[model samples]
Structures are given as C-alpha cells and as structure tokens.
Target: MKSIVFTFSFVVLFTQLAMAQQSNEEQNLIKLSLDKWQWMADKDVEKLSQLFDEKSKFVHMSGTWKKGEELDIIKTGRIWYKKVTVKDTAVELFGNTAIVWNRITLDAVVREQVAVNEFTVTEVYQKNGQDWKLLALTFSSVRDTHQIKH
Candidate 1:
C-alpha cells in the first residue's frame, strides 16, 4: 500500500512537470499572437488576419460578436485601434489549445473622438498542423479615458 502511494505521487509530479513544459511552449506561440495584435493596432489588417483561423470568432468589448473573416472588421471601419499595449499577461495550455489572458491599454479614435480604453482580453488559440491560429477572442472594456501617456 505504501509503495503504491509513493509511485502514484511520483507519477503525478512527473505529469505536472511535463504539462508545465508544454504550457511554456504554448506561451511562446502566444507571443506570436501578441505580435499579430500589435499589427492590428497599427492597422495592418492583412497581417493580423493571417494569424487567425478561417472560422475564428471575436466577441468585441462593445458586445458585438463576429464570426469568420476578421478582415471584414477592418474593411468596414466599425473599429480602429491606433496603439495597443498588452500587460499582465498569462498563458495556459491544454494539449493543442491555449488561452492567453492580458490587460490591453489602447489609444484610438472611435467615431472620430479620441479615447483611451483599458481592457481585459482573452484569446484562444489552437494548433493547426505545425502552426497555431487564433480560434476565438473575447474582451471587456474596463474604462474610457481621456488619454494614455505611453
């Protein structure tokens, strides 16, 4: 009974360690997703769209749900992000899927009025073949501010 318990503990510890390593790898993939977000803020729609899967979904802070063709959001001009900075990020992995949570501070002019918003964002990514693509994203706006200094 004692030997069995000890073996089970070791197995659990080893499994946890292995999972942590995989999570780290997923975090690295999430770094790429962050790069894509930066490009979106810069209005590089083409590049940003490439990072997402074809059937990806987005739930905007404004309570709008978008499905497929992320480029449409850029082309329609319903939203625009000029500068975005991500902070306090956490990445978790579940096999071929990962979730990235972060606080995003954005500088933008919505409806021709310049405003700053601090938002909490979560992006889900799935491994597609050798590459990881964004599967879904959801964000909530914390506040609208007058300006963002840096």
Candidate 2:
C-alpha cells in the first residue's frame, strides 16, 4: 500500500511539473543566457559588448573585472572560453530585472593552460526600453555533485 501511494504521488507531481508553462519573458531570458554562453565560447566580444552595460562587472575564478577589462581579456586571448556545457538553468524575474543561474562545466584555456571546472554562473540583467543588458556575471565554483534547487 505504501509503495502504491508513493507511485501515485510521483506521477501526480511529474504531471503537474509537465503542465506548468514558463512565461514568454522567462523563456526569452533563458534563451538569452544560452546565447551568451555561446558568444563567450566563440569570443564574439562585439555582441557581448553591446549586451553588457557600461558598468557591468564579471567575477571569475581568477579574479573580477569591469566590462572593459573583461572584453580586453577575451580579445587578447588571455582567457579563452573554449567550451561551456550547460547542465541546467533557472531564471527569476522581478519588475524590470531578471536573474539567471546556470549550472555548467567549463573547459577553458588560461595563460596557455587548459582547465575544466564546474560552476554555477549567476547573471543579472536589467530590461531597458526594448532590450536587456547584463549588469553582472558571477561564477561560483561548485562540485560536480552540486545542484541548484528549483
């Protein structure tokens, strides 16, 4: 009887989750986050520069820097984001702001050495007019077994 009850509860919970739909804005934020990851890996600093606000900030394992310094690092190959494999992503919206959390495995080249690490990347974006600009991007190192609660 206990096993049967557990099975029923699991089915109901899964059904409810599947039926839930994310709003358009939430979906757009998710898409933008994914695109940003791709742009970083490709070293498309032009698009990134446009997306990042003038006062934007970036936090990495090595250190933290402002928008200009971050762009210069990417342009000069100081730290090449060779590949990023996103395991999962979550986004929250407030008025005109959105925060995204991405669980990823990063494979990068830094100072001629390649390293792979797991990180939970948090991105904060502000909506202005018809576009959204990134205000902050922070990387938090995490264990491979770590998971973000939804």
So what's the TM-score on candidate 2? Answer: 0.85
Clashes of each: 0, 0
lDDT of 1 by residue, 1-150 (tens): 999999999999999999888767966876786787777766677776667787888887555554444466665555677777876677777888888777778777676778787887778889888888888888777764422232
Number of the top-ranking candidate, with lDDT as the measure: 2
lDDT of each: 0.73, 0.91
Top-TM-score candidate index: 2
49, model 1: CA deviation in Å?
Answer: 2.4
Model 2 lDDT tens row, 1-150: 999999999999887776564466788898898898888888899999999999999999889999999999988889889999999888988889999999999999999999999999999999989999999999999999989888
Off by over 4 Å in 1: 1-20, 67-69, 143-150
Model 2 alpha-carbon drift over 4 Å, by segment: 1-22
- What's the lDDT of the predicted structure labeled candidate 2? 0.91
Error of 1 at 3 (Å): 18
**C-alpha TM-scores of all predictions:** 0.72, 0.85
